[model samples]
Target: MYKYLFLLGSSLAVAQPAMAEDGEITVTATGLAQPVEHTGQAVTVITRDEIERVQGADVTRVIQRLPGTTFTRTGPMGSLTLLGVRGAPAGQTLVLIDGVRANDPANANAEFDLSQLNTATIDSIELLRGPNSVVWGSQAMGGVMNIVTRIENGYSASVEYGGDDRVTASAAAGMTNEKLEAALSAGFVDAGGYSSAASGTEKDGYRQYNLAGRARYHVTETLSLTANARYTHGKVDLDGYPPPNYTFADADVTEKLRAWSGRVGALYDVGILKLNAGFSISDTERVGDDPSYPYSIDGRSERAELFGRVALPGQLALDFGGDYEWSRFSNAPDAGKAHNGSVHALLGYYGDRLIVTAGMRYDDHSDFGGEWTFGANGAYEIAPGWRLRAAYGEGFKAPTLYQLLSQYGNPDLLPERSKGYEVGVSHGERGDPVYLSLTAYRRDSKNLIDFFSCWSGTAPLCATRPSGFYYNVGKGRAQGIEAEVGLQWAPGLSSQFAYSYTDTENRTPGDVYRGADFARRPAHMVSASLDWESTMGLALGFDVRVVGDAFDDRANATKLDSYALGDIRASYRVNDMIELFGRVENVWDQDYAIAAGYGTQGRAAYFGVRLRK
Candidate 1:
């Protein structure tokens, strides 16, 4: 059934007429500002207008529309959410806020929890698909997702209430002058969430608060200074396994987290050279409690970087940079610190008919050693509205602090490494009403990390064998095809369609998990949306998502069936400064689960209002 739907969507996408697009600039693909059509890599940009039109509860919903991306959540709103790209593990995907890394250093896999992120203050989002380690040092084996916050001068506020007794409110204000510009924003969310267990009557609730601020000062005509900071605090009710003699009910357990990140930077521009330097820090603390036990952990990271770009003759440019990072993890009876430094160089060429870039990086880790990585990308314009692009890159993921210093940590574990390449074709010019693209790529990874059982002695099957310990004993391969189509059908009417087909397999020789499919990765996924607005201040939108069957465990013993979901939303503008909106999610109330033993939300509705100036 999904195959048929995918075919139908493809046909309609090809048959539809072009609409129109506002010109937008993206900087994630090449570390430089440029139009999406000019970059050699696949990129997706979601603007503020799109965010307001869809009005998703969280940032994950906005990301679901991109190609080669998938998400798994334990339950409804405020649940643990993980994101995967191109069949890569969640930890392999790098996340950034205004060019600053945001992954947790204390996590065993150094992965970010997407559920904790709110979209109220985001100005734009840029998703760059495929390996990007040449520009982003670590955790770029899969791709990069960069969130840019709002900085323009304006004032806005919103409030909403809906299903599960959920309440949300947010406000922002900004001002600008000849020498300085500043903005501040804050938001709050509370929800009486559903049970986390597959079958339970007790409800688990959630609460969160967030604050963010940004400012830029023009010290001189040729130099500027900027600073930004964000903080989030959240608490979530938890559920545990059923008791031996008790029925399914809520467990007396909870978890709390507080995290903050900030960065300060300066940019200096001369006629022939541009220089940039920055310093940033991120700190996170988490606490888990039950009647009998309570524990906490802390993680922190600090980094400094300097980079320069020089303009040369003949449409050529050179870029060079270096950075230093310090990471630390602390807890009772466990503490560790590590330092890393890296240098990189890139060369680029821009011409009327071709664009080319090549880069290399060398990294030195205090504990392990040193490694080198390189990449190249090229795009050629075949005609006025047609182009061909190809890219090849290498990526690496260092062992996280928790994986190397905790009780089950392995001090000798090696870093996971990968090599990948892609070739694609694109049609339609920038700002055109219709654009289409298709790409095919493959990646091979080695030294993947996993926990395995180990015995005290050299004997096999020893009775005193330890439960498990981390090891570098895994390998895998992923190959996939991606397709995307965008159309501006008419004035106030627009649509988008995206599809991904991925095939992944374990390649670890002589390992028990060899030949098994990567866990929680669907082989087929599709997303499509259509939106329309009327001159009378009325807007309507519809979206559909389809996910194929997948296994919940590495052994492939627990299977999750395929499912399709749909959503509908509408909005009416009362005046230039006021608007009302509402939405219905899972309109058909389809029974599905992204993870085994987890409960998903049913049909739910929400209503809200907004004021802007």
Candidate 2:
């Protein structure tokens, strides 16, 4: 079924550009909501049109090519998507939906699984590489990924269906006439997922369903209210290992999980002062069927944040914000809770050719006490198309409920913290068709955590298991470089290529001296793509992604070699109201794992038709 779709797409000519903006600046890292070229942080932006073309199964596949990002493989959940921004631990990074924090508080690492997010609903994603805790608070140790949903001015709807039992449908409409404007969007998605574990194995297959809705209304010219809600349910069929040399497992097991989240926000602009406030809630549940693996986990999380900025007469800007968050996790015999509060402020000085930004955040957590983060950023325009930027900051991530109070968890876990710095160079004519940027960064983490003993329920040997009790390990450091080039060589031809590399290590007291390299983080990665409009109503594109080798264990005992993958897509307009398209993924049939023990899809394809009025 998937093959036929690609075939039809290949038979078609090409695609046409949609009604999308080009080169919008991002202000996620600065906390000022300004453009990237005017800020010091290293940033990468993926436009909505690009997201529509990739149509990947998950965010990992979608942004893998972005600089300093890598992916790990896990069964059913598929690629355990991990982004190594400046070589920091995946758990140290923070992900945001709109402006709301989206990292899971129930997990040991306080990391948000990109796998759970449906990219079909995303309008754009910005990757900010560097410490940004002064603005975003905890878990921004490595970087920040801000996902912005689409907003429309009028009625718009789309239904997309493809391979691996994947289907998606979405609708968005808005009214902007008269004195009021309102917009609303809803989406649904389901997938049977990719094949991994063998038959009768202890690991299970994957099945997932998701739904999301968003709405916004303008109460007045400068006042607005927005709300968003989402629900997801997924199950993993697990299989146990195959005896003796349990180097890897191929068994099938059953794991069920459900999650729901909602958020509401209000914004008011009164010339000199712009004020914004929002509240968010999330709940999660997980159930496992196997008695040896009999597990039940539940968690509830809530957060409230307020932001305000004031403009001064002399090109001086002052921004301030505060946040309070709480979470509770329960697994019957084991339970835990955490709470934290933070206040942050930024002072910015702006000039025609230079901008300086300074900010700091003070957070007090129930478990880890108080932590303070500070950052400084500055950018200067050196010439008509060149800019120089520098940034330095401190970041942190609090331990999650699972790390603090699970069956074999450690309640004494400490928050991991880091100090980071970055510098970059960018060149591009304002509103030009070509741009190039490069950045170098380094981050060091303290009080890192790791598993120590095994599950202690039965015997000592069982506790010796790899997945047994974990504890704070010590310190580590990661450093890397990122580079990108965006070009529009002709009227209808445009291309982009980005690459990243990192050096990582775990250096702490009494830790096993394995190797210099950190496990699971590839040293090199690259992504490139080209888009072109062949005719009045046809468009064509091709994309390629590559990753280097990485270890499968902390001991660095095993390694998965590097591999590259490619994909092709094309679309044609049958008429003004109808269009046809198709896509081919893994065109090279690369048989490599993002992690050990898992098989990536070789070569696959899919087709579809789109209609518009």
Q: Report clashes for each candidate as comma-separated counts.
A: 1, 34
Model 1 scores worst on lDDT over the 10 consecutive residues at 11-20
Whole-model lDDT, model 2: 0.70
Give residue 597's error in model 1 in angstroms: 0.8
Q: Model 2, range 258-357, lDDT digits (tens) per residue?
A: 8777777666677788766667787877787763457787778877766678989889988887767778988777788877877889898888899898
Off by over 4 Å in 1: 1-23, 245-249, 428-432, 455-467
1-613, model 1: which lDDT tens digit per residue?
3223322322211100001124656566655455676568877888878877778558877888889999988866677788899999889998877666788888878887887678887877888888877777778899888887766578999999988888988888998887887888877889898888777667888898888887777788767677888898999877765466454346776889898888877766675786666777888888887554576878888777666679899988887766778899876556888988777888988788898989998888887788888988889999887889998988899898877877767777788899988999988742258888899999999999987656433423223335556778789999999998989999999888999999999999997779999999999999999989999999999999999999998999899999999999999999999999999988999999998877888888999999999
Scored against the true structure, residue 134 in model 2 reaches a CA lDDT of: 92
What are the lDDT scores of the predictions, listed in order? 0.80, 0.70
**Residue 157 lDDT (model 1):** 91
- Badly placed stretches (over 4 Å) of model 2 are 1-27, 30-32, 76-80, 154-194, 198-206, 242-250, 407-411, 429-432, 454-470
> Residue 363 in model 2: shift from native, Å?
0.8
